[model samples]
Target chain A: MDYFIELFFSGLTRGSIYALIALGYTMVYGIIGLINFAHGEIYMIGAFTALIVSTVLTIYGFPLLAVIVLTALAAVIWAASYGYTIERLAYRPLRSAPRLSPLISAIGMSIFLQNYVLLAQTSDFQPFPALIPEFDFMEPYAHIVGSSDLAILVVSAIVMILLTFMIKFTRTGKAMRATAQDRKMAMLVGINVDNVISITFITGSALAAIGGLLIASHIGQINFYIGFIAGIKAFTAAVLGGIGSIPGAVLGSFILGLTEAFATGYVSSDYEDVFAFSLLVLILIFKPAGLLGKATVEKV
Target chain B: MIFSKRMLSILAAFALAAGIASNASAAETIKIGVAGAHSGDLASYGIPTMKAALLVAQDLNEQGGINGVKVEVLAEDDVCKPEVATNTATKLVSENVNVVIGHICSGATKAALPIYRDANIIVMSPSATNPDLTQSGDYPNFYRTIASDDAQARTLVDFATDTLKVGKIAVIHDKGDYGKGLAEFVKSFLEKDGKAEVVLFEGVTPGAVDYSAVVQKIRRSGADAVIYGGYHPEASKIVSQMRKKRMKTMFLAPDGVKDDTFINVTGKNAEGVYASGPADVSKNPLTKKFRDKFMATEGAEPGAFFDNGVTAALALTNAIAKAGTDSAAIAKVLHTETADTPFGAVKFDETGEPIGIGFVVYQVKDGKFVTVQ
Candidate 1:
């Protein structure tokens, strides 16, 4: 029972990270109807940006909170620029071309970004200083749980709550929803669809930047390619949550994370991925839309 | 008709002159083909290896030349893929390189060996550690300066069973040639001792962010220790996950996870993890000097495989110095010469591999790697 609880919390913490990243994927897909593959590269860029900023600040003897805030700002700026540039250079030109063209271009852009970072950074795993101070919170339950696990859970929950409030109450959030539902209708109704779309990207990228910062803080070092796997898992989370549904992405992330944790804890570690992907396949086959996602009929 | 004939003669004359110039340029420089993972996850090792090779060429030229002829090092990015390695080998052969130093991964090196052997070009690896590369009876030109996976595995198993007194052990591998091979060796050695029971044996994909499932299983398996034969990235993730789950089993790994990146990635969770690798960093004065130089120049300590790159450069330079410019003669001298390197004295056995390099065990304590007896 203790083992199970530990696994459950571990999974939830991991899932929270995926959920945060998935929010970025689902939001852009919701507004633009394009699966921004380069978003993963954007996340990687964010992490690197945060890493560089934090390292520089630490060298200058700045306090941890100051370093973290500066790093977050840098990550947001870098990721926003990257998202904007990718959209302009790769997606905009192919907006009128076949759907496959833009998707292929996004993949090409991802590869280009990966190689660009590799060439610039020399393909080494540089250490990212921990921005969060280590505090033992679950000391009483040390045998069953750990401080890092509790920290990941608490931080993730706070971030998610704040995000939920932003999307539900903010003005830009309503415009985003309006744009997602009908781009043509939104434009006809005097909505600045392009601006709404860019804002949606900025919002999603900011969240991803936060995720990148947390991940860098959790994992002490990072490299150019760190985002690829996490990005895939987050995409899986988005799909699991009903891609385009914000709350669904969060739910899906938790499920994926917890499942992986439990599987690795009780079953074989090698089969953790097999189990996760299999669940995704099973969910797709049975629900077709995802656990929290709505089913949409395809146009004949 | 006369004007048309004159125009044809002029075009043919120009084509002939261009062909001659191409051939003349090609004949002037001896190209040494180098292959490594220049653009993928392992590019950290590959890029530095290439840089070391280039430095060797620059050093050689400064001392006159290789047999009165300037040496050229042409690099190809294999991306650590076997198919790419084969393709790169074919391309290098087509380019008529006299020798090569590449295909960093054991599996990739194995794939390219047949092509290089068939083309009669010597292929040396700075980091390939799979024992089967030379033992497979197919490679005559393949050589590696570092100790093999088996050697590192033996060192790790000895530390776990004899020093740590780990009664129950769980083994995890990354499903790659290096990881799987090392894990298998460690498992076999542990099983032979009968002091340890193998509770769980599993493989994980590389670059995974979460490894809670495997960590949880190990926790439940009643294992006192876990050995992961993989690179630092995944190892760090696993360690972090284990810390999250509150599993207290001691972690162990081979040289692949012995980098400072492991501690950086895992933070405080990296403490107490034992690692076995060639003690090149602590065993040699030249390595210490090079480490100082690298830190002074690069503003940080070189990564785990930096010394391996330097040793490879030293080996090639020594072979070239002895052979006096002929690559075929250099290959002969490489077989005969036994010289001290940054990693200590290295001598190739009959199959063109280093003979007696031993592995050392170390443990992470307070974010630093400290040698363990």
Candidate 2:
């Protein structure tokens, strides 16, 4: 029980991060039908941004609280810009081309961004500051859930809740849904599909930036390659939850995270990845459209 | 048709003249090449080692050329890869450098050994510590300043029994050749010593986002301490995870986790963490002098391996000064003669492994590694 509960929290913490990143993948795929492979690199860039901003802000004598807030703002701002730019320059140009073209371009963009950051900063792992304050009261129960882990769970919950509310109640959310359902129909109905698609990217990237900040702080290190692994897991989460479904992405992430945690704890950590992938195959085989995904009819 | 007889003759004459002039210039300077991962995963280790070699070469040249021959340092980035190491060794052979200072990774050193052996180039690695490199007996020119991984394992095994005084322990490895081999070596040695029982010996997949399962197993086994044979990144995370679960089980870090990065990443969780490594020579006057100068000039610590690099460079330079450009003469001196290095007067056995290399145990205190034994 306590052991299983601990694993649950750990899984939940990891799942929330995966959900945050998966939302980016699902959203881009929802609005434009492109995988947005470079979305992972954007997350890495966000961590790097936070690293630099916090270091500089601390050197300039900003209080810890101020530095933390500014770092988050700086990371989201920069990552959002990168997301907007990538969609505009890479995906937008290939929107009307064969679907394969944008996919290849997304991969190319991913590589380009990885190397660019490698050259600009460094290839070595840079330690990220533990932005969350350590509460001595939590020390007694630190083994169950550390302060940073708690912060990750709380922040991600709030972000997810806000995202759910916005999508359900806002005009832009309706436009986004309309665009994802049928781009031609959405455009014909004066939805300004382009703006809606860009906004989707912005929101997705912002969420990913938060994920990057949270995970970097949680892991205590960030590097150019960290994003690649996190991105793959998040992409798997999106696929597992059903591509292009927001709630589905979060749900998939939690399932994957819990499975990984439980498998690692009960079986062997060596087989953890094996278990996760086998579960993915089993689920996909039976559900095909993913756990919460709707069946799509292709007009032949 | 483009090259008539007269044009061909003139071009050949110019080429012959240029070749002779370049040969004369090459004779005036002895070039030493440093090859390693100047970039990529192990760049943190390789880049600094190469930099220390270059600094030594510069300081040596400034003090007057070795044997009246000026020394020049050339560097090649092997990216800590064996294939790339072989490629870099071939490039260094083409450059006709007098000796080489790297292939700092064990895999890279092993892969490039044949090339250097065939080319008759001496490779003095500052940090490659795999026992197989020196034990293979196939390469006579290979040498390193640090003790082999087997030696490190032996030291840690002793520490586990004598220092920690733990009866039951669990040994874990990251499954890499270096980590797995060292962990197995330690497990075997511990068993042979008849002091403690290894409750669990298992391999964990590195780079997993979580390792709570491994921790749970270790906890259930009720091991007194966990000896991890791996690099710091994974070790730091593992230790942090254990501490997060509030397990105070002792964690022993090998040379791979002795660096500052481990402490920084683990932070407060690293308190009471024990680490093992070859004895520190940083306190020696000569090494301290170099470090002080390096710190003031370079704006960063040269790292633990840096002094070893300087020592390796000094040994090579001593051999070079004793024996001119003849690589065989240099190899003979390196094997038989004692060289005065910052690590103290160092001597190599027939296998080129340092004879008197030692290891120590350290504990992390207030975010710094303090020598415990």
Candidate 3:
């Protein structure tokens, strides 16, 4: 029973990270109808930014709390800027062009950003300093889950709730939804469709940045290539939950994470991906529109 | 446009003479191809070997060259991939390198060996430790300064059973050619030793963000120790996750995990982890000379395979100088003659396994890997 609980929490923690990154993919897909292939690179840049900031601050003898806050702030801001720039430079130009053009551009941007980071920094894995301190009251339960895991879960939950509230009640949120529904109609109604798309990209990049900071700290390492695999996994999660649906992305992430955990725990880590993808295949086969995805009729 | 048979024969003979002339001139500058992953993730391992080869060539040239002929280094990056290794090998061959120093990582070494053999270029690896490279009797030209994974696995299993006295062991691998190969050896050796019962043998996906599930499974298995077969990246992740989960099972791994990067990446979580690596011979004056030289030149401590690299460079140069450019003579010299390196006087056996070079288990204490007694 203890083992099962431990696995459950592990799954939740993993799911939270996936959800954070997948939200970016789903949101960008929702508003702009682009996969935003460079979303993962944004996450990687976030981790690298956090790593650099935290390392420098710690060297200068800053307080742990201040260092953590400053590092996360730096990561989010830098990643959000990169996201905005990428969408503007790569996607905006190809908006009226064929859809495949922007996708190919997105992929080229992904490769370009990866190489850019590689040249600017290094290909080596740098040790990410542990920022999350151990909670005193959680000592007894530390055996089941570390303090970092708890922090990740709580932080992700809060971020998700805040995002939900913003989307449900804010003006910018309504603009985003309107733009997502129909870019032409939103523009016709004076929605400033371009601004909504940029904001969506910024929001999604911020979430991915948060995910990168947490996961890098949790894993205790960061590299230029870390974004590629994380991006692929989160993209899978987004697709599994219906790429354009925000809630579906969250649901798919949890399901995927839990499936990976239980599979690795009960069976073997060798077949962990096998089970996760198999679940995705089964869901796609049965529902054809993902678990929470709504099948829409295309207008002629 | 085609030549007649008589004219072709004459042309072929003239071409052969020209080839012989070029070969003779090539001997004046003995080109040593340093092939390995010099630019990618495994660059840490390969770069040191390349640096060592370059330094050795410099030293030899400084000392009036090898047998009055200047030594040269031609480096080609394979990025530790097998497919690229074949290209690296062919490139080295076309460059007319007299000898090859490395194609680090066992898979790449295995891939490039046949190319070197076909070209009759003796290839010595600084770190490739797969047993089949030597034991398979497929490549007589292949030699390595490091001990094979089979030997490494035995050392690790022996330590786990005899030193640590762990009875139930869980073996895990990254499912790569090197990692899976080492894990299989560990599993078989453990079964044969009969001191430890193999509780769980599994492979984990490399580059997974989290390994908590595997950590949970390890805990539930009740294993006294976990033997891992992979590089530092995955090993650091597993060890960090296990410590975070408060699992006290001993973590043991092979040379792939025996890196300062592992300790750095894992930080405090790296404590008490055991890894088998090339036996330390730092006490040797030759070792000290190279160590100081590397530090002075590179401004950093020589990394994982620096010693092996020194040995390989010394051996190759020593062989070519002693036996001239004849491939057969070079092979015989490598077998019979010894090159005094960081590992003391080093010589290759008939099977191309180095004599005297072996593995030692090191435990991470505080923040560094300390050699275990």
Candidate 4:
């Protein structure tokens, strides 16, 4: 039972990261109806940003928390700019073209960003400073919580709660919902749909940047290709939760995380993905619209 | 008709000049082909091996060239794929390279060997560890500087059973050619002398983040130790997961999981894990010198296979020095000559396998690998 609890906490920690990145995928898909494949690259860029900022700060003997804050700010700003430029340049022109065109362009953007980072960074795994303090909280509660596991869980949970509050209570959040539901209707109703979409991208990108920071902090290193697999898992979480649903992404991320944890704990660790992805396929086959996702009937 | 005659004369004169220049330049420089993963997952290993080879060629050229003939290295990216390696080998043959140095992964090297053999180009690997490369008995020019998986397995089996007194063991592999081969060899060797019992044998996928079920099975199987034959990434995750669950079983691994990346990824969880492979860098004087130099220059420790690459390069340069100008002659000398390398005196048996290569056992202590035996 203690082992199970330990596994649960570990899963939650990983799931939180998946949830954070998944929010970007769900938000962009909600507003633009494009997958925004390059969202992963933005996450990668955010990690690199944090890596550089933290390393520079460390060289000057800055406190850990101060370094973390500076790195997070840098990552958030860079990711937001990257998100804005990608929307303006890559997806905007293809808005009128066939649906496949924007998707292809997003993929091209992703590849372009990956190669660009690879060329710039030399494809090496650069060590990043551990921004968070490594406290041994597990000593007193060894049966229930490990220090590393708790830190990841708490950090992720706080981020998820903040995101939930932002989407539920903010005015821009309402506009995002309005734009996602009916772009044409939202525009006719003076919603300024374009601004709402751009804001949505910025918000999602910022959240992803936070996720990137947490992931780099958790992993204790950064590389050019770290975003690729994490992005896939996050996308899986979004789909599993019911894409376009904010709360759904969080729920889906937890579910995916717990499933992976359980799989790793009970089965071979190698088959963790097989279990999570298989669950996604099974859920899609039966529910077809995800747990919280509404089924849409295409007009024939 | 008069205009056509003038154009034909010009074209004929240009073709003749190109043919003459090509022949003259081809004889002056001997081209050696080096192929490996330059741009994929294994590029970490492949890129450094290529760099070391280049450095060797540079050093050779600076010291009065090879027998007064310039040595040119032509590098091709195999991306660690067998099909790509074969194609690269064919292209190298077409380019008339005197010999070839790589295809670092065992699978890729094996796939490209037939092409190299058919083309009669001597091929040597700095890092391939599969025993089958030379065991097949079909190629005379193929060589590997590193100890084969069989040798590593024997060393690991002996250490786990004799030194650690690990009686019951669980075996896991990544299911790749290298992983599966190492696992089988260790398992077979362990049970061969009726000394060790393998409680569970299974295969796992690579690059996974969790291993709860596998650990649970090992725990239930009543095994006192777990032997993993895979790379550092998976090994790190497995060790971390075990620690997270507080499982106290001893973790053992082969050479592939012996890199510092294991400790980097696993952190404190990596402590006490036993790994058997080549001697630690600090063990030998030559390796110690290289390590100090690498740390001072690169600001990082060299990877586990770095010495193997350097040794391989030295072998090639030594053969070139001994054989004089012709590449085929160098190939002949490589098959017959014995020379000293960083790994000690390097000599290949008739089957092109390195003789008397040694393996060491080590344990992770304080986030660094310390040689235990």
Candidate 5:
């Protein structure tokens, strides 16, 4: 059915955005055991950076391909900077204080960053230019598909694969896993726990920034406070998939996005959010540790 | 050469009394509270509205004040939230303001309506378009420069049926006070006429990035025209997504989607999209000078709601000039008489709705909003 196909494509696109953001939550939670609530703000700032960079590129009349590449690079680099700064300034000092301390600090940083962008930029829903071009292959099926949607799916898939490979094979990835498994033990084994955590933040921030860039291009609208609602949904996805499980986070986002799209398509759009959150509650009741999460024992 | 204690005391008292007399004279100036989302997401609307209020007050003050009272305008940021709106109204009431020009969002206006109603504060909202603002008769002291949401139906129906030749219409709303209210009005308007059948009617959550489901339904229903009842941001997304989905149905919208930002957001896909609003005041002969002054002050081209702001300000100043600062007296004048504005002479109907309303439609052509009707 055309109806089914329509929902599928939209669900995939929406799910990819959620998955990217959820990866940020899962990554930080896995490494530091503290949810980087400000990850959403990093995404927002990244989109802002992309918008500025892309707009300047357009003014300079750069080719579309070069502009897109450079803009993504600029956004990733800037967002990684924000990620590094937030982790160092807000979470690092409070890392050893108490579990609640870093969390509260992350939330405070989220609010602070949101207000900071609000001050720096106009509060209006500024238009984001359409950066991606229509492709020759999808010309006929433009009704059922879009180039941007394809780009979202492909880019997100590649990112996930690369992230998985890095986690599996790379040295820093090994250090990250060691740190996440046991920070004290990893540090004792000369794994450089703080460096691993910082690397996690940078990588997670880069993923979120790309999510921001892609979604901004798809939606063609950006504002200061989009991060809050998005952050909440991604957090939900992280919990639904399995907190601290990277692959689980992506799966949960896809599920969440599919549920919203199908619910809106078949039942009612009014109850779309209801379905997403309700699914979370039902899943939590059935599996407290989430779909792919393992139950951990407290070490004496 | 120290003065005696009594002399010092007398001098201080004399100075204090003199200051008090001057302050009392200053207090005679009429204060109008322009409450809206001056700081948050809706500042695009509120800032322009507030600028118009400020410009009108400045012009009045320069002319030696209105009715021998200099106009003092204070803008409060309600952040477009209901609770904050009520608080803003209460703050304005405490400041002894007799008139409140805004709280631009319909939800915000609804929240603060009862406060102004009970206190007899005249509120001439610039952009709040919910029919409930005046139709309920719960707030006789409230008025607006823009037409009621119901007027949007009246604005779009004729254009949709005759001009666009849309037979089956699909009406979609964002489920907000303004958006849903306008959608209901359009639905009822067409249903009453029995001219065009509404094939698909739906409500959507605003600020959600996806509307593909809604678009697919519209395509399936074979509705020749789709009417969006919401602000430009959501409209832009829906329009862009609809086009991407290859839905060939023509798009028609209420004034909520008339902003230039809509075009920018939708880009090339925005062409041929139709929008309706109550009379383009930009073409009025009186608006040129005002527009020039406004551009100088606001540092950009005026938004769609700019004139709504100026109109609200003019309504207040003219009524206050006639009846002084008593909001009850201003309401009496506002009800019984018409206020001349740059938009034109605006009078209220029995329900305080704007009378002699003229609605027009515009279509986006070559990346510009060109009036078609």
Candidate 6:
């Protein structure tokens, strides 16, 4: 029972991170109808930004709380900017072209960003300083999870709650929903669909940046290629949940994370991904849409 | 038609002149190719070998070169990848390098060896330690200054069973060719020794975001110690995660985890972790000489494979100096003659394994690897 609980929490922690990045993918797909393949690079850039800022701040002997907050702020801003720029430069230009064009551009943008960072910083794995401090209150439960894991869960939950609230209550949220539902109708309704799309990209990128910061600090290292794996997993989560559905993305992420954790725990770690994908294949075969995804009928 | 014929003659004349110029240059200098991961995550391991080759070449040239013929170094980056290594090998061969120093990772070395062998270029590695590289009998021209994984694994198992006295062990690997190969050897050696019972043997997907599930499994298995086989990036992650989870299980690993980067990354979690690396040669005057030279030039202490890099470079040059540019004679000299290296007087056996050079265990103490008695 204790072992089960531990695995459950581990899965939750992993799921929370995947959800953070998956939200980016689902949101971009929701608003612009493009997969934004470079979403993972945004997450990587976020981690790199956090890594640089935190290192310099720590070197200057700042308080841990200050360093953490400022580092996260820098990462979110930089990643969001990169996200905005990618959508503007890569996806926006081809918004009216064939759907495959923007998707290809997204992939090209992903590769371009990866190599850009590789050439700009290094291909080596830079050690990320421990930003989250050990909590004295959590010492008893340390055997099951660490301080960083707890922090990740709490921060992601709060962020998710805020995002949910904004989307449900705010004007921009309505505009985003309207844009996602029918871009032409929304434009006819004076929704300024372009701005809504830009906001969606920025919001998604910011979430991914937060994910990057947490995971990098959690893993204790970052490199140019770290984004690719995390991005792929989160994208899998998005697809598993129904690509354009917000709640579906989160649900898919948690399910994938828990499945991986339990599978690795009970079965063999060798086929961890195998179990995850097999589950995906099984679900897709039955539902055709993701777990929470609405079935869309294409007009013939 | 006459003008076109004259243009053809000019092109042929230029081609012939270029061929003669290249031949004259090839004769004037002995080209040594330094190939390895000068970029990518494993660049730390490969860069030192490149530096070692450069420094050795510099010293040899200053001292009237190899038998009065100047030595030139041609370096290539394999990124420690197998496919890239073949290209690196082909490029070196095309450059007509008389000998090659490295294809650092074992998998890359395995891929690149056929190219070097086909071209009859003797290739020596400072860090590629797969036993199959020597034992497979497929590549006669391959040699390494480091002990093979089997020998290193044996040392680790003996230390765990004899010194640490851990009876139950969990073996983990990154599922790469190198990591899985080393982990398998560790498991078999532990099982054969009968002193320690193998509790769990598993492979983890490299670059997985989290390893908590595996760590929990290790806890549930009730292993007294964990033997990990992989590079520092993954090792640091696992060790740190274990530390975070407050698991104090004894952690032991092979030389792949023995580097300053591991210590730097794992931070406090790195303490008391045992790793078997190339035997300590810090006290050797030759090692001190190279250490000072490297620090003075690069302004940093030599990294993971620096000693073995120096040894491999020294052995290659010494062989070429003794046997001239002939690959067969150089191979024979490498097999028979001893080269004074940082690893002490080193000579390769017929199988291209360094005879006396071996591994010793080191435990991370106060943020550095301290030799274990």
Q: Is candidate 1 or candidate 2 better by lDDT?
A: 2
Please, what is the TM-score per model? 0.70, 0.73, 0.77, 0.69, 0.75, 0.76
RMSD of every candidate to native, in Å, equals: 10.4, 8.5, 6.8, 9.6, 9.5, 8.8
Off by over 4 Å in 2: A56-68, A135-140, B1-146, B280-342, B345-353
Interface RMSD of 6: 0.8
Supply fnat for every model shown.
0.63, 0.44, 0.87, 0.14, 0.57, 0.80
Model 6 has fnat of 0.80
Q: Candidates sorted by lDDT, descending order?
A: 6, 3, 5, 2, 1, 4
Q: Candidate 4's residue-wise lDDT over B25-119, tens digit each?
A: 76897676888888888888787777666666776788877778777888999999998988988888767777788879998999999998887
* Top candidate, metric lDDT: 6
Residue-level lDDT tens digits of model 1 in A1-300? 877776776687688778768888888887778898888888888888898888889899998788877888999988887787777788877877988998899899989999999998969887777676656655566545445445566766776777678777988777778887888999898999878877777777777787887876666667889788789999999998888777888899998888787777766666788889999999999988888787888789
lDDT of each: 0.79, 0.85, 0.90, 0.79, 0.85, 0.90
Over A127-172, each residue of candidate 3 has an lDDT whose tens digit, in order, gives 9988888789888988787888888888877876888788889999
Q: B1-373, model 3: which lDDT tens digit per residue? A: 3568889999999978877886887967988899999998999999999989989889999998988889989999999999999999998887788899998989999999999999898999989977889999999999999888699888899999999999999999999988998889999999987999999999999999889888888888999999999999999999888887778899999989888888878888899999998776879998898889999988999898988999999998888888997889999999998888999888999999999798889999999889996
Candidate 5, position A120, lDDT: 98
Residue pairs in steric clash, candidate 6?
none
- The local lDDT score (0 to 100) that residue B249 gets in candidate 1 is 90
Better of 2 and 6 by TM-score: 6
lDDT of 2 by residue, B1-373 (tens): 6669889999999978876776687798988999988988788888777878877777888888897778999999999899889999998887777899988899999999899999888889988988889888888889888888798888888988997799999999998988898899989998899999998887787665556667767887889999999998889878977887789899986889998888887888889988887677767887887787688778988864888888888889888899887888998888788887778888788898876566888899998999997
Model 5: per-residue Cα lDDT at residue B37: 88
Ranking by DockQ: 3, 6, 5, 1, 2, 4
lDDT digits (tens) for residues B147-205 of candidate 5 = 77677787788789887777999998899877888888899999998889998788888
| Better model by DockQ: candidate 1 vs candidate 3 | 3
Q: Which ten residues in a row have the lowest lDDT in candidate 1 chain A?
A: A142-151
Worst 10 residues of 2 chain B by lDDT: B205-214
